[model samples]
Target chain A: MKIGILGSGNMGSSLGLLWAEQGHEVFFGGRTTEKGRAVAALAEQGTQGGTNDEAARFGDVLLYTIRGINPAEVLTSVEVLSGKIIIDCNNFEIPEGFAYAPIELSLAEKLASQVPNARVVKAFNTMAQEVFELAPSPLKDYQVSVFVCADDAQARQTVMKLAEDIGFTAVDCGELRHSRLVEGLGNFIRFMIIGQLQNPYTTLSIDVLPAASEQRLGGRQP
Target chain B: MKIGILGSGNMGSSLGLLWAEQGHEVFFGGRTTEKGRAVAALAEQGTQGGTNDEAARFGDVLLYTIRGINPAEVLTSVEVLSGKIIIDCNNFEIPEGFAYAPIELSLAEKLASQVPNARVVKAFNTMAQEVFELAPSPLKDYQVSVFVCADDAQARQTVMKLAEDIGFTAVDCGELRHSRLVEGLGNFIRFMIIGQLQNPYTTLSIDVLPAASEQRLGGRQP
Candidate 1:
């Protein structure tokens, strides 16, 4: 599957490496062809790079990793993003790291409205750069959860496979409205972790207790 | 010390019963003298019930369990909460069953402002009513956790011990501003539990890993 990464920042590059390592065709969407090429060259062999618009057209799915607020411009800057599975890994946190409640419309909502016909799913917004670096699943030889929320069932299935393929346990957290809870949890941690307190190592473990029976999710870690 | 609980609801009654059980002079504050006496009669032996003003004056510490939006009116109706340790358990969420965010002043800040000289500490704002009723402590008894946030150290310590005496594990979550995260977590769970994805019986147990080599706060479970 061709996976396109929007925004060639640290997160976009990390995802590109992960996907390319898994043998999927990974594309980096950058403002310029040269920037996109730089990110692609950083990926494993067979990975390709292109301009933001070219990446959108080239991939089967497009992932949004830009700042939570930056997608508004990036979506419009690119000519079209309709009918593509857009995974939102962005959050609308104000500058200076103050998590003052959430915004009027979540980033996913705005993206869905702005990019008409785009199948948007909220995932991977709650994890840190290191957690992505350490993606867990049966694919990765462990099980860490990746929560997926979307209105489209097929779109959710597509996202789930990609998540599992990339090596993380995928749990569908119901429809898109649940993104409010996702963003709220993220915001709470953003302040709690970034704001700095005791046990500031990795903020929190995204893994849930595996119901005592499921060995993969949880079993005698303590 | 005489302890007062305004708004004789389940929460108020729960705390009052437990605290009175622990030998604190607990008073259930109701609207009128007769109403207070009726509830008091239903309470454990030696537990007192009185009018709102009388209860507020009867106790050295007052715990306000009134509605979130009208904290000022609620406390003012109590008549004499000034210069007392009034524990706040309020968060400003809309009554229409939606996630409400406070833009102007947070509920903790508002409660502090409402009771000018009263030393207001935020506690019992993180757990569900059921969790509070069970009363878990770090010592291995049914230990329910209640995060505490306050500006005054002595006042916070005082509340922390009171929380322990009533079978709760009070984690000092920094100052009052940090109460925002606990409030958001509590609100998030309030909806999440009803949503059924999360196991309501799942409790977050804060323990020191053996590597950390920390002893239990409540000592040990039975």
Candidate 2:
């Protein structure tokens, strides 16, 4: 699969390298191609670096990791985004590193609205860049959940597959509207691990224990 | 410990029974005392029933589980709530059962503002009432996290202890202002488990894996 990373920051670089290692063609895009090229130079596989607009046109699947800027403004540089699977990994935070004040629509939802033609999937915004750097092997025993939410079912499935391929458990949160909750979970995680616990290595996962009836049934359906 | 339950709903009743079994004196309070009385009657311990105002004045620790109505209006019935540790176990949801539109202050935060003199601690709002009914023994192996947050450190610790006593792994989420994030987590869990997976038996938890350096050090500090 061709994956375009629309930022040259830690998250984009780490994910780009990881995908490159997985034999996916990765294009690292940046405001200036220098940083993207430097990141791409580290990869031995089918990886390259270019301008954001070039990267946007290069891949069917795009990892939108740019922060601070309005996504609509950024996407305007690209000619078309229709039918493209845009995996949004952006979380809005204030200067204090906490989440921005609650808004009516989440960042992902806003991005979707901005680029109505694009199949927007919200994923990978919950964890830090360091998490992507230490993916799959180091945390194989523990299930690190990557929540994926999208209005398009197929896009959601595609992004979930990408997450699973990277050795993380992907939770399907359903619908673009549900991005608000996912973004909230992202902020909650940041507040707990970074703000409260002072632990950067931590991540959140779900533990679904069997019901009493399920236990009594001994694997049999009720 | 004298624990006052300010509602006769499933959450209030379940927690009231749990605390009662843990040897705490519990006062189950409701709009009308009949439901509270019936729930309290199920416990063969130092437990009783009363009206909301009576319960508010009865215990050193109070469980604020009343929903729908504004907290200020409910607390008005009581003469005073100064210095009392209030465990806020309420999550605001619309009639459709999804979380209410995102607001500036969380329900717990709003409650804290309403009762300025009370020591407000947010906890037990993330899980379903049935989870409390299951208790510690059934979920002994799983580390089900109960996120506790309060502006007052002592109140936070008190709530954490109560959560631990009930056999949950209590996570200290620092200040009460972070309640917004916790509430967001509650909504995320609901959307994923009930709305998406259609599984009422599931819950979310944190899985903090060791860092690469920690793994390499083999119990030695760097």
Candidate 3:
């Protein structure tokens, strides 16, 4: 997959490097070419870096990692995003220690509306960028769940496969509207890790244990 | 500890039975005495059942599990909830398949304002009631996380201890305002289990795995 990262921040740099290491063609894009070039220089050989527009035009799949700004301002700079698989990892700013979603739509949903033709999938927004920097396969003993939500099923699966490629459990969280829930879960995780646990490296996973009936009928026919 | 259950629904009955079995004086309160009586009849000996007001008056800790209706309507029926630990397990109605919190406050936070003297703690709203029925110690291999949030430190600890007594891993999520995140997580879990997995028995947990540095420093000092 030719992957484009729309930000030179922690999230974009970390994910771009990981994907590049996994043999995916990665392009790191930033507000300035020099910033993207700096991150790209740290990644694997043959990886490219350029302006946001150049990176948007470079890849079939774009990882929207730009934070603390309205996505439309950055997205409008690009010429064409039609039919591209956009994995939205952006979150609303928590200026006052509380994450507030837009009244009716989540960040991802709003992004989808901006690029109407692009397939917007919400993922990689739930965990810290440090998790990506940890290793190719970070939680060796357990699986860190990456909740993926998109109206486009194929794009959702593609992004899920990419997440699995990096060794994270990808949970299919249904349509784009459900991004509101995923975004909320992201806030919940942020508070849990930074506020309560006081640890940035910590991650969350959904552990589905065997049902009582399943346990009861362990040796018997259903 | 005396415990009062404000609703005789699935959540109310399951938690009430669990607490009653734990040797706490349990009271099942419902819209009608008969409704509460029916559930209490299924519990251990000495467990009582009556109207909402009687149950509110009976227990030092009250579990508010009423759904669909405004909590203000039900809570107003009770005479006094001063200084009592009120574990709010109610969630907003997801009528159109999305859980919507109030514009300015979460359901739990709103509950706190309605009865200012009551120490409102949010817990048990994130999982299905069947988890309690699975056994006193369900998910034996894995610790199912019960996220607890409250403004009162003592009340928070009390709820956390109660959750632990039922074999759950209680996570102190800090103040009651953070209940917005927990409630959102509840909605996320609901959609994942029912809408995505098509299983009511599934549960979620926050598994904070070893950080990269911890893994790197295996058997050595940090």
Candidate 4:
């Protein structure tokens, strides 16, 4: 599978490297071409470096890592995003580094409106960069969960495959309208780990614990 | 400890019964005296039924289960809630039964302002009635977690002990302001279990799984 990573920051670089290691054709895109190339080079092979537009047009699936209120400015030049699986892992952040979008609609909803034809799936936004660096997310001997939400079922499934490829247990949360809940969950976990409980990065991973003897969608761990 | 439960609905009754069984003197307060008495009667002993004001003045710790915009209207008749630990398990709900305030401040925050003197601790609003009814909350051999948050550290600890008395692993999330995150988390879990994923009540319990070998506050399961 071809995966394009827009805004080659910590999330983009980390995810791009992982996907490249999994034998996917990964493209790292950013304004700083050298930085993008540097991230691509870390993958060893089967990865390319390019500008945002070039990466946008290169892949079957495009993963966005940009953060801000205005997504239109970022995707304005990207012409080939329509009819593509776009995984939105971006979230709006306040000064405190907790996720918050002042707008009535969520960032995912805003992005969907901006790119009308793109199959926008909200996934991986809830995870912290430090957790991604853990490789297989060694938490309680269970696969750490990555929740995906989108209107398009197929697009959600595709994003789930991508999440599973990264060794995450992908669970379908709901439609894009439910992105607010996902983002809020992210903030909740952040506050619990950093703000209140002061647990270290290695201490927490979102894993669903099913009731005894009950079957769930995601493979139950232990 | 004497526990006064305001709004003798399902939540108030279920929790009051549990506390009563745990040897705490419990009072069920409601508009309908018979209904409150009936709920209290289930516990057999160590429980009483009373009006809202009677319950308000009865206990050192008061737990509210009412859900409405105007908290003042309900607490106006009560003379002394000051210098008391108030357990706020109330969550604002929309027509869909999802937790939401649609206001600037959370229910716990608003309740704090209205009472002025009570130390408001938010806990148990996130758990479903089914889980509370479960004698031990049978979830993956681990006790289901109940998160608590409040400004007063002593009050928070008191509530955490209360939560433990009822067979839940009570986690201190943060200050009372973080109640918004708890409410959001309730909505997120509700959406996952009922709205989207459609997992049964018998299949879900809020559990935190930390990375292996990491020191965490609440007792690590497994």
Candidate 5:
């Protein structure tokens, strides 16, 4: 698969390197040409680095990893990303302390509205950059569950497969509107680790488990 | 400890029964005396039934289980609940679809502001009534984790102890403001099960796991 990473930041570079190492053709792109080239050099598999516009047109799938308030401005410059699967890993700014932004409109939803033609899927925003560094599988006993939400089933499946490619258990979390919940979970985890648990980002990854099968029957037994 | 359940609903009744069975003095209360008495009958230990006002005055700690739009109205009617630990388990109504209510001010925060003297702790709103029905432990391999949050340390600890008494592993998730995150997790779980997974309420319970210890060190080891 051809993978285009739109930012040369920690999250973008980490995931881009993982995908490239997984034998996917990856293009690392950002405002800083030198940093983009430096990140692309870390990949053992086929990889390249260029401007955001060049990378946007170069891939079957694009990862919007630019951590900014508005993604529309950056993405609008790309001439041809129509019908491509765009994975959104951008989260709104965390205010001082641990309180998250009051999510009136989700970033994924906003991006979807901006690019009417593309399929936008929300994933990978819940965990920190250190989490992505442990690709394919974490050192934990439980699998790191990634919640993927998108309107298009095919697009969601593509993103889920991409998540699986790097060793994440992707759970379908329904439509684009459910992005609010996913984003909220991300913020909550951050708050729990930093503000409450007082633990560093490296020590923890969000893992969800299922209930026992026998307990599935509704109502109390006589 | 004297446990006052201010609503004879499923949540109140189930928890009140468990606490009563655990040898705590439990009082079940609601609008209807007959219903409160019937709920109180489920408990084996020392328990009683009465109106909400009577229950409010009867205990050192109170569980507000009445599902209502405004909790301030219900709590204001009872005088002298000052310095008492109040556990809030009420969740705001989510409309027909998966969209959650935009909670600008959390119910726990509102209740805290309303009754300036009482200590408010938000908990148990994440799972369904049937979950409380399977008390002491779930059928799964791991113990179910319950998250407890509040402004008052002593009050939070009291609620955490109460949660543990019912066979739950209570995790302290910081101050009262973190209630929004806990509540959001509740809503998100609901959306995933009902809206996305299309699974019925009987089939699920929220389960969270811990990460490995070695993974806590920041950055990759080159």
Candidate 6:
């Protein structure tokens, strides 16, 4: 799969490396040429970095990792990603240092509206950037659960396979309405860090020992 | 020490029953006398259930389990609760449904404001009602972790002893502002259920084992 990543900051670059390492043709779409080339050069799997339009046109799967506030204008500006499986990882809250609620519109839902024909899925928004970059598998043999939300079944299935490729347990979270919860979980990670007086490292990832058939109802204690 | 519960709903009543069974004088309060008595009668600890005011006056330390939307209002209505050590367990998110970002006031801060003399420390917001009620702790052998947050040093230390009595692992989460993350983690639990199409019973418990001393500073491996 050819992966196109818009916004070559820490998150985009980190994930871009993962996809490229997973035998995917990864392309970088940075705000500047230097960043794009620099990220492209970091690839061991022939990852190439290009303009947003060029990267958008060159890939089968795209990741939207831009900041929350300006995603609409940025996506509109990137017009290259007209129709594709665009994974929405952008969150809406700004680091204004004040906690607000009733986040009127979600960045994912807003993107879906703008690109009606595109297959958009919401994920990775629930995890910390560092967690996304690190955090080992919760399940030893199987995969770590990743909550995925989208109206399109095919799109979700495709994304799930990608999650598996990247070593994850992809749990289908009903529809786009769930993106609200996913993003909420993401922001909550930040809150937990401050609460623990621990530097933001990522959420505490649990190692789930698989249950026997009788114990499979849910991950409850015996 | 006597235990006080500020709500007679499933969560509050459930914990009240457990504490009373453990031979503690438990006072559980609800909006109505009827609801409180119904739950308290089942406990058989001579547990008293009455108006919120009665619960506030009854307990040595108060456990607040009300909705976050109106923590200030709840405190205002129960004015006698001033100057007490409060177990603050609430999140201020709009209940209509999950919104990506909560566009409202921070309820904990509001709570701090309403009860100026009260010593507010956050705890019990992360557990499932079932875990708080039924998860047996073999006395520090396998106690669950619950983070505590507050500005006052004495209040935090006092709650630490109270938390041990309740069979939990209470980690002090810095100051009052840190309360947001402890409460925010609750949003992750809420969203995980909403996002993954799972129930509270099955999904809420994230069995976080004690982070090994070396692991805590080393890395967050869950």
Flag regions of model 6 displaced more than 4 Å: A31-34, A68-79, A92-102, A126-129, A132-145, A194-196, A204-222, B20-24, B29-54, B66-79, B88-101, B107-114, B126-128, B138-188, B191-196, B202-222
- Candidate 4's iRMSD: 9.3
Give the per-residue Cα lDDT of candidate 1 at B171. 67
- Residue lDDT tens for model 6, B2-73: 767887776677667766766779888777777777778886568888876678888877788786544455
Instruction: List, in order, the clash count of every candidate structure.
Output: 11, 0, 0, 0, 2, 9
The digit string of per-residue lDDT tens for model 5 on B73-119 reads 66546456788888988777766887886557677887788778889
Tell me the DockQ of each model, to 2 decimals: 0.10, 0.45, 0.43, 0.26, 0.37, 0.20
Off by over 4 Å in 5: A69-76, A139-141, A200-222, B69-77, B139-143, B200-222
How accurate locally is residue B98 in candidate 4, as Cα lDDT from 0 to 100? 47
- Which tens-of-lDDT digit does each residue in A1-222 have in candidate 2? 998888868888888887887789999888877877888898878689977876888888999988646555665454468889999998767437464488578899888877888899999987776666456565545678889989999999999999988778898888888888888887777776677777776788876768756564232122
Summing lDDT over every window of 10 consecutive residues in candidate 6 chain A, give the lowest-scoring window: A205-214
DockQ, computed on Cα atoms, for candidate 2:
0.45
Where does model 1 sit among the CAPRI classes?
incorrect
Give the TM-scores of the predictions, in the order they appear.
Answer: 0.72, 0.90, 0.90, 0.85, 0.87, 0.73
Model 4: CA > 4 A from native: A69-76, A96-103, A137-140, A200-222, B69-72, B95-103, B135-140, B200-222
Please report, as a residue range, the 10-residue window in candidate 5 chain B with the lowest summed lDDT: B202-211
lDDT (C-alpha, whole model) for all candidates: 0.65, 0.79, 0.79, 0.71, 0.74, 0.64
Better of 2 and 6 by lDDT: 2
Chain A vs. true chain A, TM-score per model, equals: 0.81, 0.90, 0.89, 0.84, 0.86, 0.81
Better of 1 and 4 by DockQ: 4
Clashing pairs in 2: none
For model 3, which pairs clash?
none
Worst 10 residues of 6 chain B by lDDT: B202-211
- Mind giving the per-residue lDDT tens digits that candidate 5 earns over A167-188? 7777888798889988887787
How does residue B64 of candidate 2 score in lDDT?
A: 85
